[model samples]
Target chain A: MMHALILPLLFPLFAGAALLLGHRLPLPAKRGFSLLATLALVPVALWLLLLAGDGQLRLYAMGDWQPPFGIVLLLDRLSALLLLLNAVLASFAMLYACRGDDERGPNFHALFQFQLLGINGAFLTGDLFNLFVFFEILLISSYTLLLHGQGPARVRSGIHYVVLNLLGSALFLVGVSLLYGLLGTLNMADLAVRVAEMDAGSAPLVAAAGYLLLIVFGLKAAILPLHFWLPRAYAAATAPVAALFAIMTKVGLYAILRVFTLIYGSEAGPLANMVSDWLWPLALVTLAVGVFGALASRGLQTTIGHLVVVSVGTLLAGLALGSQAGLAAALYYLLHTTLVSGGLFLLADLIARQRGALGALLVSAPALRQPLLLGLVFFAGAISVVGLPPFSGFFGKLMLLQAVPPGPDALLFWPVLLVGGLGMLIALSRTGSLIFWRAEGEPVAERADGLRLLAAVGLLLGSVLLVLLARPIIAYLQATAAQLLDLQPYLAIIRGGEA
Target chain B: MEAVLAVTLGVMVTCGVYLILRARVFPVVVGLTLISYAVNLFIFSMGRLATGAPAVIGKSASHVDPLPQALVLTAIVIGFAMTAFVVVLALRGLGELKTDHVDGQEPRE
Candidate 1:
């Protein structure tokens, strides 16, 4: 059963290698292999999820070396859930990319596979250095994929994309080295145990290392001030690429959430106090900036990018609350935000095409203003994005609001939450007015095909299901949060001492 | 002992920031390179700057902290790859936009 933990990590890596090998095959054969490999992942992911439900955490030592001596891949409930989500989204994105022009479609699948491998590896790895390695794999493949088969604009944006992440990766390396120097281990669970016993005098160095690592996560998550590369990159990519990239930002939030919970606790005296103190204000600032950026968008794509920022900001704020309830809410918010953001990006593609195509198709028919079915879908998307009730976004935001503590100066989590909600509404309002309500411009002539539309509908429905199933998810999240705070289990996993 | 490394780090940060702020991407790349070097030295010193100790003990008793050195060695290799990738990305940006600004689409000179 423990071997099941390794499947999510190994499956994608093997799948990507297989795709590279079959790259020269006939188109039909290539598609079959890629789809089959991705489809094969679903049951495996489900199996791992089932295993996690049994309260059985799996740790596979790389090359049969013991923990703290060799790299490890850990599969707790949290990692299992994230790994499954990453694979599902990747497979769906691959299917959606099948609609692309031949020049871009085949190579697109290969990069999708590689990106999944990197993302899953990042989620599963137990060592800090290995996480950096996986992040590089994700970044490099994404860089190539971003530029391949796009116009000069995408190529240009890819430069900013590459430089930003490349710089982040370097900073990550520095942080890892410092951390290893200070703690004598790069294994994350080991570091957590060892760091607990470190001298108070060495706090400054540890704080620097922590901040550096935070900056890396911040860059990837597109938190305020470090998010310049995101809007342009997202807006310039093809629809499927944009959709896939939306989830990529969530991976960053996942890392930050994972690291903070695993490495530090709010109740743990001076060091924990310092981290929480700094994060709370930074999170508030990030939230304000994200909402402001979201409000500033003139286009649907940039608006979606800002939404990514807002979701991350909210997640960070939830983390900053530094309570068990806060962490659980953050987890719920992460899941909700991933679905909402991914759906909204795909909706942008649909709207763009709808406005453009209806303009062309209804050229002489002046009486028919909007494409009825498409406009209805856009309306649902707009409402969902704005966090209206009965939608997944609403539940997540509500949970976050309840979990956040009142500020010291005033009881004020609601005011900030309201501002963010308003910012989302205004952004979506502008996009809706421009795309659907306004008279159509020249037809885009670039409508999504059947497969793309199917994926979009399926994703939206899945998010609704997520809201319906919130109770169980909340229980799981609370359990995960309890485990994180417990820390004894984490220490035992690495040292084998308590066991 | 502490003051020299602090000054060196400050100088590296200054030069790196100056180079990164320049209009050309190469200088920015060079700036990134300089910053990384300073970062490495700074992180190395954070191990508390002990000397005459090898990371690995040669089947004998004298063993320095091996982890940071191992981490630094890997970091150096990864940093080189990162630098190489950025250089190639910069060249690509230059070829595409006819300028070397890392921002890539800044109003052409």
Candidate 2:
């Protein structure tokens, strides 16, 4: 029945609808409902994962409408895998947020559920305009969450964050419009077919459209030069909010990979190559700047924010390499970064709690119950971020390096790679020492609930599991990459109308 | 002729860049709005302009690309939402802190 295809989105959608009634419920009930609803997503996600492994694909059309006219939901191995991750991450983060002594209000739970709806919708929607609608839903919920707690700094920074993203959304709209104008359809599969049929006279227009689209995606992904808004925004957002944002970049990366592979493969246009080439140096710069920003920050939260940027930069570099092997590495690293960054942000929140508040965490050194956990988490995250081994990061980089053909300029990549690695190490050393080791002057306080700690552990341990499961993961990534390169299957689905 | 519109858009972008670089919050908001306008126009231009053709499709006649128009329509609505949100945020800042500075009153050392 392909029910697996619809469950992930439906679970969130129905849960969110129920949440609109949650405001009338008691706070405890509201929190309970949200957590239960989020946890309900897990089983469906797992089933979808199973279906994806069996080489099954599902496409759901709105209101029995045909493609090139109506919105569509597509389920592929890549989308299923990411959808599951989003549900799992959100469930854990909700558990963390809804825990005792810090229970969020009804609106918080409602907004959170809707946020998941938007995020999952964005991941699964095959129609570009539908993607935009879902992005707005996600962004709007995020804006509310970002400014949920009342404070001058959060409120102020929240505005800036909203403004910047609003601009990105506007850019996204423009890009999508241009894409629609060039082609007759906003359906991705249709666009892909039409894009491949472009003649020389229309080539420049297509290229421009493609580049503009990349710019919008790149900004959302926090690729270098467009990243000025990230650290500040992440630094100021509450811990759970920041943790949710940790995977937002994955959405952007997902869009880039999806659009380029599905609609604008190498043969379709020069835009793909141009984007890949242009991103390399900027990614290196983003890596450098992020590491340095981390080094410069005194607060655990701000430092971790910078670290997220560095990982994003590294992912972009891998993405820009534009080979199946490189994409495989990128896919692996993308999952790794989401887990590690999500974990570290949780740790940062815990550390912030230990110091009383984020501002206090910056001024006073926190004494954690398991001080060793901080160091251990930092070590694993740093190792992964820096591409050091026994971890998945090293193996992913190894795959990427192996894929770079023996071009004359191949040696040039090494310096940027080395410097980025070193920068990661330096940032880790500074922030780790400052937060865990050298800040002994402050009074030790009772740590927060164990659920936050558990969420962090879950994410970190899951990443270590990724390292152990590298063989299967690499196989899956390659399969997805191959699927991407062959657009005929995708074309047939949207065009053929076989349910 | 279209090149001149593109140039005007470029100049608007430059102005936005200068405003975004400023330290005041209001200027930054203004800059963001201007940048969005520029982006909207840029996207519209990418469709490769057609003469006096409406976006709606007809059975026999050629229509200017409707997709870009649809896209631009969506962008304009979303842009307004963003602008409204930003304006509300800026107004909230004015009401709460009574200042429009980029950095909050709290000092970072």
Candidate 3:
């Protein structure tokens, strides 16, 4: 099963190509095939997770070429966890898409698979340039996916998203090229080694490149100032696309964590802990801004979009702590937020569909066809998202708060995070009452689709499952964080390969 | 030669940036194309300016770094595809909203 390391990337690649070629096939067949491909990833990701659980860094050099010269995909605890997350989220999103969303545009299933391929490749790749390529793959697929349904709002947002990300891509190449020029290698491990040994004379240039990369990743992650694009783009995306996009921002956070910890980490003299000072203040403001946006938003989808930004802010805060506990807390919270936010997006879509012409706007509309069930799901999601007790969100936030050592940073983080949760609580409750309680008219639409509800509830249940399996998951994440902070194994992998 | 290449890149990027800031989609697309061109040149130059050296080894005593050439190739292809997509998207936006303005409406005069 050593070859299974490449399966995550290949399954999607082949499946996407097949779907594109067979685009004329019946929708059921395409759905069945796409669902099968996506479902298969779960176990594959699980197996990869089990493999990575053993604490050994697994490297799959493309075409059997060695690292520092050839491309390599690496699997460790962090990548495995993210792969599993993406697989699970993609599975649910794919399930939801099967209920007619895939038919909205040409090649939705193919684009989705390509998106997964890019995301999976990104998590697995250890080469900087390869990461850039994967980013483009995911991004291009995302641009099409955003415009999948073809609406005025989507085009407007799509233009901004495409143009901005194109610039981001240019910046990404510039940064990668700068690093390659300075270090003469694109392999991440080799770069880490070289960056550490780099003299002070070239420090400023490397720092510029590092910060440039940060800006690009920050744009992807939607950190505060660069975050204006997110709510519009995500809100304008179709439901399943929006659900899948919950993992997209995490990819940015993941890159930040990966590059900062691995390359510019403690061992990199003169460049050590460079992102910490910048990440801290930005995270606080992002949290505050996201909450404010959520509170002010008129539509449910946009509210959830802002909530995604809030999650980004919270996760960045956990990462900003710059400790093993902090990373572990952030990873756990990442699992919770990605799933629940995805569920909320799907749920919001369901609500929008039932509102007749009202369509996700927060105004009082006709009651939903299945108000009781949806309201229950909404209540549950709200509880989890608001960081209330007994759900994964509460525990995730608790872990993050506890992870923060008592310091000025804690003082800043505790209030901003707690208050942000309170703000979410207010926003969600207002939305729920307006949609479910304050309604005076009859239910507008027929009973909701079983598959769609299942898809949404299935993902929302992920939060509960996280709470159930909190012990082992948190333990694994702790080890992952420890592994990330401990650069020796990663650096040693290159040395081992060179020998 | 290096100074000239650097100046050209700077000029291209400046033009790209200026055009991108415009409210119109056509200008924005043109700007993006320019920027991608500048970025491609920048990546190519990262290999340093070498006129006569062969890219492949064994044919010459000193070979130019072939890596950035490969990198630039990949970047160009991706950039080309993106430009095509954005252009089509711009046309679609024009059809749907009946405006070339990025905001999907004519700015109030």
What is residue A398's positional error in candidate 3, in angstroms? 0.5
How many collisions between residues are there in candidate 2? 1
Candidate 3: fraction of native contacts reproduced? 0.80
TM-score of each: 0.90, 0.88, 0.99
Q: Write the per-residue lDDT of candidate 1 for residues A260-334, one digit (tens) a residue.
A: 777765533346634566666666777777788778765678777777777777777887776788888887877
Query: lDDT score, residue B94, model 3?
Result: 98
Using TM-score, rank the candidates from best to worst.
3, 1, 2
RMSD of each: 3.5, 3.8, 1.0
Candidate rank order under lDDT: 3, 2, 1
Error of 3 at A112 (Å): 0.8
Candidate 2 lDDT (Cα, whole model)? 0.75
Q: Which digits, one per residue and each the tens of the lDDT, describe model 2 over residues A224-321?
A: 78787788778777777788888887888888888877777765754445566677777778878887887787777777788788878777777777
- Show where candidate 2 strays beyond 4 Å: A1-3, A100-106, A269-272, A357-370, A373-381, A407-409, A494-499, B1-77, B103-109
The C-alpha interface RMSD of every prediction is 2.2, 2.4, 0.7
